[model samples]
Target: MTNVLQVIPARQGRAVRLQAGQAIRIVNTHGTQVVDTWCFNAADMGEFMSMEHLHATLGSIFPVRGEPLFTNRRRPILILEEDTSPGRHDTVIAACDVHRYALLGCRDYHDNCTDNLHAALRQIGLRSDECPSPLNLWMNIPVAPDGRITWGEPLSKPGDAVVLRAVMDCVVAMSACPQDMIPINGADCRPVEAHYEVLT
Candidate 1:
């Protein structure tokens, strides 16, 4: 099957629909960018992908290839098909929002994952405040021996990617993380292009 590729600009958002049996590949084009991702059942938004359910089902904080991603309704939505980078994706961190920037001492408006998610969802005529926490791809948040979580730089190199097959028809939303205040995307907060491919 031919693949359809979409490039998500730095600090921007995108929305796409995937049918069951189709796969989406997210590429870390520049290596240091983090992609905040979320998925919803195409038939019902209430049964969206749940990070809590995934944690409970997998018993792990990070994603592993070949594992199924469960929704809030306990149904499989997508399966991790492949991972080319070090498997350090995070599922525990909440998407960045306007309030986070405020807490970080930034009184000005900043591009954030929450707003991006809303904008992406809006493209499909779905509007709600029930934005689910996302699976943070290529993001490095290491847990210390003392249970301390520290934000670190991503481990993926340029062109690294992860592929996931949709178990059910779903709408996927993604945001190139725009956090410049931390080392999550290396020294600077500059965003980079993220390449996405949908393969039938």
Candidate 2:
């Protein structure tokens, strides 16, 4: 039996420590929800997962099973073990921040992925500045033939999940992506509950 470590709610964030050989399973409880994820070396905060490195290493935008998520230091941090969704996750988009909201014409304070990531990292004695761009799980932002990217609803179904195993001791942070302005979350902006499990 696997032990349940933490369960993160929609629009919220969580940070957990995973040792090498351990895995964290992220479940899309309601489907169509995007999970923004970040990883960092536990011993050295400066070394964290890098999307640019991953793309250069894999030569593809999407992650495949059995591939390692490379960090800025050119080290493997996590390995993609399993994915049940439609494999539409993204790596190009940056987490939403206050400036983004302002550009969208939102005057009031809005809950965003960047802030959520910072909050989660704070629990581990880290700050927002240390947070890096994340692996957008279940997100669908497809590039057109003209090289324009289009945001669309996620292809993940209810109960869809992805399991990633840590290759080294690291801190894993996640945000349920509270992007309400787009169809990424069904255009309702209502966040759903996301289930997380750390398996030994």
Candidate 3:
């Protein structure tokens, strides 16, 4: 059976449930949109994917295809099975929030990934007070040898996709990052929609 494609609308979010051994194929339909992704235990929301633990587990900030995405409990939550992009996902930047926009001189309300995550969860009748750092798919942040980091446009092209297989039953949430203030999404600094499919 074919898995149906679902839209993660630009400047919005979506959430889906997955069983153990299942996978999600996320597509960068427009090539430039950055997807902020998060995974949580289906039975316990507190036990979710942890970037800090994942860094210590992999000994690297960049997670490659075939590596397991670990949880705060230091257990495998999901495995990045395939990636067609340049593998430049960002692991350090916090999801964009209202405060971030304020710092950017936005005096008005802006669509943000942090709010998107929580809203997505609530759509599925779930709730998480804590916003764990997300796996910023396609976000390019280059770290210099001098310990400075520079935000760069994504190197991924249109139709680039990634398959993330769940190691355990989980709920995956995704936000098409609404960061038009920077060029991390693309050279045009415009956010766009992406798509995903849950696979067995």
Candidate 4:
């Protein structure tokens, strides 16, 4: 049987898990940090983390109470189970990658979200390329009337967290925002930790 556990980032590490139907939650140990995320299925790869379908079903791009969290097939994967305000999260922002590095004028650093993503991969004993895109669950990006997404003011406070219950066993990867060049990370990315327990 699969069991739940608490994982820590320790400022430079990541918390990753291969939860098969077991629920898991990541807390923003510190407020205002973007949690770089990635996911994969222990079951399938083609039907992997699809954010487009998730946004379509969860209209205007935000999760709400009693709403079904989306899967690659646009079906419910995890329910919002608990949150301070479903409105406090953002599901549109894509995890930053090397290409983004060039776009963001960080060509000198050469590091990107993929670093954290790769870390997540290593934790689960997989390669970075084997991972799928992730949803910025509580990163708080807002859509302007012109269909533009702006980094909105953060809505999560210290100790505030998003809780999700897995409708199916799945693998997820997380980072404590190692970004340091974006508004989402205040250009000073640091670390965050997560704790999980099965909700029986």
Q: Number of backbone collisions per candidate, in order? A: 1, 0, 0, 3
Q: How would you order the candidates by TM-score, starting with the best?
A: 3, 1, 2, 4
Q: Candidate 1 on 11-78: residue-level lDDT in tens? A: 98898889999989999999999999999998888888899999999999887999999999989999
Candidate 2 lDDT (Cα, whole model)? Answer: 0.88
> How do all models score by TM-score?
0.97, 0.96, 0.99, 0.79
Model 3 root-mean-square deviation: 0.6
Question: Which residue runs of candidate 1 sit more than 4 Å off their true CA positions?
Answer: none
Which residue pairs clash in candidate 2? none
lDDT of 2 by residue, 3-85 (tens): 76467877889998999999999998889789999998888888999999999888999998888999988889999999999
Show where candidate 2 strays beyond 4 Å: none
lDDT of 3 by residue, 124-176 (tens): 99999799999999999999999899989999999999999999999999999
Task: Name the weakest run of 10 consecutive residues (lDDT summed) in model 1.
Answer: 123-132
Quote the lDDT for 72 in model 1. 91
Q: Which order, best to worst by lDDT?
A: 3, 1, 2, 4
TM-score of 4: 0.79
Q: Among these predicted structures, which one has the highest TM-score?
A: 3
